[model samples]
Target chain A: MACVDDKGQLTASARKLLETIENNALTPEEIAKEAALPLFKVRSSMRDMKSMGFVTEEENGAYQMNPEASKLLKK
Target chain B: MSEETMSQVNSLPRIGSKAPNFEATTTHGTLQLSDYEGSWVILFSHPADFTPVCTSEFISFQNIYPKLREMNTELLGLSVDSVSSHIAWVRNVKEKFGVEIEFPIIADLNKEVAEKYGMIMPEESSTETSRAVFIIDGQRTVRAIIYYPLSTGRNMDEILRVITALQATDEHNIATPADWKKGDKVIVPPANTAEMAEERVNDDSVECIDWYYCQKEI
Candidate 1:
């Protein structure tokens, strides 16, 4: 049903992580490097975004933006 | 706090009590326990994702999903893993086992659902949930609860049989014998009065081994 919060908002760190995964699936380390954030922050943001159904994990332990997340990005 | 006190605080939902409700992110979508208000729910929790035992259990659950649906039941799986891990595991299971898990799996990283369901047995493992199954009826009341140690896999046939038995008992006011299956004779409730006990002896419709033990055909 309501996949996102009432505000349909993503934190700045979450948005950075989501943008990195929007094109290619990447592990937390890679996302941190690409987003210029620390690895620990990327990891925590990924967990938060994942619970919101924004990103999904690949078989290789890489994270990618789900379709629901893509829609959010477009909006 | 003492172990006993901690356990008492996180005790499992008792049978005949209302199932605790929660909103969780799942593989299918964000869903609440109230979503399946008019159907039976098999809310099960595994220890983790990608583990061998949990993987096999997921496959087994997928195999019986159709059968359960036929009985107006829905399956919802849970683990303390993140949603990303759950998605990865689901894909892996499909590729390796050739069984697609159609049911939604709750990603309980916060352990909200697990704590409410008393799935995490502290004695077993503080971080992971034990193999727990809660069968909630259409009315959202818990009808049965089965818990297995982390090592032992659950029995699908037994789960199905119990659902059948519960349904039959509700429909006919009867009880099921040990190892009972569908189409088998069901036991009648024991008579409480002397006259009813006497009538049970003369009731040809039922087979009575004793006054308290009587069975009738469904």
Candidate 2:
């Protein structure tokens, strides 16, 4: 696998998911269902988003959208 | 399909006009044609990076890379494959075909670049892109364009001939005739009147077949 760029930005797939989840908090399963992504893709995207500071996961297993991703969605 | 349908298919990124600027993360990271402002760009799209037909085409392009570079042109390839897939394909081409590709190929996983360039046709292949080539001048204006069917491979000789023809026209302000090849006689546009035609024959350098037909050795 290729290493991420040093900027900590999301890869293309991760970016697409962040774009999808900007409006509201969605669990990995919900993200996979709504975005037409597979389960593994949702997990990978969530991990990348969390690392890039674009998402935060709750103790109850829900993912919350971060402000950066929210701003991108508004645009 | 009909010519009208093909023209409609290629209408998104208008041919014989400026190619649209597209920024995408390729196998070599973020790239854009605007970055190479002072040189020519040959941006081509393949069905998929690792497929058999595309592999041969890529190797052919790579073999011609040195010549293209000598003419101050750069090549950029594209497909709707992941960057890792592109990397693997490049390695495969080098190892098996004995040619090294020294250009960046856009991954275009989301089909953004392909859509922007009209490279993807759902009617052609729902999951793959069509074979597309756009030759842009130093000013980022498209000079020539060619599209090949999925099964038929592109002619590298024809591509080189077109570049030579375009460059010659730009330098000499002359137009080439149909099926023009390098070092072959070039067509001189007929002068409008009999007086100009009479003067053209006496010019000595140009061969006049008739009053309207004049050929010049390039």
**Number of the top candidate by TM-score?**
1
Per-residue lDDT over B95-208 for candidate 1, one digit per residue giving the tens place of the 0 to 100 score: 988889888899999999998988989999999999999999988999999999999999999999999999999899999999999999999999999999999989999999
Best by DockQ: 1
Candidate 2: segments with Cα more than 4 A from true spot:
A1-75, B1-11, B193-195
Native contacts retained per candidate?
Answer: 0.11, 0.00
Q: Write the per-residue lDDT of candidate 2 for residues B130-202, one digit (tens) a residue.
A: 9999998888888988888899899999999899999988887678989988888888878888899889978
What's model 1's lDDT at A4? Answer: 40
The CAPRI class of candidate 1 is incorrect
Docking class of 2: incorrect
Error of 2 at B194 (Å): 5.2
TM-score of chain A of 2: 0.71
Q: Which 10-residue window of candidate 1 chain B scores lowest in summed lDDT?
A: B28-37
Candidate 1 clashes between residue pairs 3 or more apart in a chain or in different chains: none
Winner by lDDT: 1
DockQ of 1: 0.07
TM-score of each: 0.73, 0.69
Q: Per-residue lDDT of A1-75 in model 2, one digit per residue for the tens?
A: 122335644456665677677777888778877887544346645755576667899887678888867664443
